[model samples]
Target: MTNEKVDVVIVGAGASGSVYASVLAKAGKKVVLLESGPDWQLTDLISSEIWGRRVKPAGAPILLEGKNPMAYAAQGGWGVGGAALHYYANFPRLLPTDFRMKSEHGRGHDWPIAYEDVAPFYDKVAREIGVSGDARAEEKWRPAGEAYPMPPMKTFRNGNIWLKAFEASGIPMVPAPVGMNSVEFKGRPACLYDGWCHVGCPIGALANPQVTYLGEARKAGAEVRAWSTVTRVLTNPAGTRVTGVEYYDDKHQKQTQEASVVLLAAWSAQNPRLLLNSATDKHPKGLGNASGLVGHFMMSHHVASTWAMFDEDVQNHMGTIAVQYMSYERYPKKSHDGAFGSSFVTAGFAVKTTDLANSRADLYGPELADYMKRAARNLAGIKTFGEEQPNVENRVELASEKDEFGMPLGRLIHSFDSDAVALWNANFEEGLNVARASGAKEAWSARGTMPTSHLLGGTIMGTSAANSVVNSYGQSHELPNLWVAGPGIFPTEGASNPTFTIFALSQRGAERMASQWGTLTN
Candidate 1:
């Protein structure tokens, strides 16, 4: 049977897809957004950590095989907001140097577009999303942009302690620009700073797509189909364009939804996996694999933390579960002594009693309880983040085994280079110094066990189709109507948090599609 057609079909209801849906719907285009997970509401957001586990994608587990295997589910969100539901809302712009990775640094791939191209969108998204920060504090490292709409969130005692420590070490610590409501901008309430951002925010204080763009799209008459897993992008006879998508509905029945244009915003790992799985006889490798780089260069940032046992009670759980202060002293390659690349440092991290107890393997029962009690009152820490240079060997290829949906699962293969290891080690020492300066009686550093949520560069964008999957507009090189959004399109993994960049890129992509599709005038 012939399927219902729309002006645009966006796969994934996360930040990028939701933003695209909102823009198109407001521009008077008919839009249908398909999500692999269920639709979530404000009330559905539970404050408990146990309940937060249910918010991640579990439809089918992604198979990981690498020296540093990514915790795919931990980094991905399942419901309407996608992974943004669990994100801490730390939004920072990529510097001008990030776009010219190869030309300037002779490492990583250069972006098809420049910082100037995406800067306006960054300002637009920051205002729309209600970021709270002192832009003047970030002026040294921040790209040219408008000041934040809201003042930076109040620094807690923990932040004050860390800031002094950072300052003593000659490290420049500035207020973190986070996409969180400091004083109720755009009808959203101010953040209470309950310190549960790693879970889900129930009050709409943080700018999850469910409360921001997706909410606007719903009001603008965009249709969102949750629990709808898109299986393939159906191509035209010439294999020159996408006609629609085939997906399994909530009821487990297969259905087709036709559209003039199709956008994939599923996520980094999944976006490339979907394209690779849609290989047809006409395009044996994959629809967009003519360049043979669809799933190559999959990269995630490396994070390591230094824990301190302080003499005073800093109350680490009192404020937002975000980086309150940051130092970009080593962000430029020329600024650091060791390593080919550089890293940034964040002030402090949120902690819980159970999480601390579980870390010490030697303690159990009463001993665990005693240690947790002492740790809760005296423990504090700072985390350092490093950039990952894209490597061809680091990728997501389809596994031989298929999931229940008749699609091949992705087998991720990733490894950090010597430069990356050196970068992490260099920053790790700096973090310990900062912790010790915070008046810690003892300080220890450890490598992060799991992968952070910053996933980038699977179907990366570049000037040449020979080196990339999409153009700067996020449109597939081979198929004009097929677009890919989200962090997966990043040509190089910048040192800053990626949510803001992703938002800006998606807005630019949607505007480009609108201009080309002639839907804005329609």
Candidate 2:
């Protein structure tokens, strides 16, 4: 095996990994970022919804294909930028009460670090990534922080409809906090309100890794080696620290790289997979698997959508992927009963012409044509996202089956408990009610099946080694030099999009690594 040395080795050049690489490299540390996919550029992001499907691999849409398919509740993105390349840019922060979910609501475990502790980092990430929102509008849930770097995207037709419905229901609707550019912050141009973002933004208006951390990291002299899949992390004989990583390059040739520290930012599934695959004599089960919690406690938010046929056209498919509003002011509170509050957003409704045409396939001739004709108009829709409690049994484990690489594929055996199911049903009904209040001709609620975009808490963070894999600062309790920098470290899945939180945690981990750089031996 060939060996090369670096100060830090980061696996998975995704959202979290990109930020960590940028931060550490900017601090003048030598870093190598290994990604399983090819290097993609903003220009390469196709603008068609159907064509964007090519960006992610088949079978495993959101995650990289391994031994077993990596299943996400929504859908995931793969490749050099990881899932961030396909993110909707919804950048809401975790509500303050989200930190103490178990204490306040007797649900999931509380975070060792509170919203207050990470508030500054959140602000830093928002500014660095260029958030365009009105923090004042989110006063009830957002922590006290500096103003948004840019103004909010203009309200769209569907947003206006949803606003009225929320007003009628006594639920306030505020501009959704998005990472897309509103006024050209960070050298990116403002959004053109093209409504084609769900397909991936070709323009740099959306703050995907290509425009944010990846660019900065590359400019800072860090090397991102794409199509280099890390199979296992190697540690010293004592199993006290990481030595380097073994990977398969684009040519399928095995190679090794040494580093003083190794950071696993490969999302919830693969992070634990690498650790488990790296079993050695010193750590028989796996590296840092002393607690055997590496692949436990998988959490994903429950998402539900409500569609309405409004009397007036509410063209929703007209702005950023997610452009309208969010309601979390009274979330997770008593008003919602035992059901937790959900973060709801109303985007310019997608025109149902395509859906209608697809649905007409079973029907014949004139009836199909008539249905398609009527579906051409804008149909307003609102989606509600609710947090799921992290359950240890809902986990990612190595399947008995192996992939082409001879590595055990990640198999997700997740089941939502009764409480989570109840919360989902309640949120769906709430969304439908809002649609009705908006004076829609008809409203339909769609429950989530295998839909998930935000995956969190597999190798969760906690105060003790007995209960968690990582500590509050993201350092692995079982392996000190090994760190996790992603939503995987979250102890609880808060009712917000996790991109911002991932960046905050990455910044925190990077800072700690920088502070302790001297202690790390190369």
Best candidate (score: TM-score): 1
User: Which tens-of-lDDT digit does each residue in 347-424 have in candidate 1?
Assistant: 755666544664454578899888787788677777777888999898989998988898998888878887778878
The estimated TM-scores of all candidates read 0.96, 0.93
TM-score (C-alpha) between model 1 and the true structure: 0.96
Off by over 4 Å in 1: 358-367, 448-453, 519-522
For candidate 2, the TM-score is 0.93
How many residue pairs clash per model? 0, 12
Looking at model 1, residue 437 earns an lDDT score of 79
Query: What residue pairs are clashing in model 1?
Result: none
List runs of model 2 lying over 4 Å from the truth.
Answer: 58-74, 338-369, 448-450
Find the 10 residues in a row with the least total lDDT in model 2. Answer: 59-68
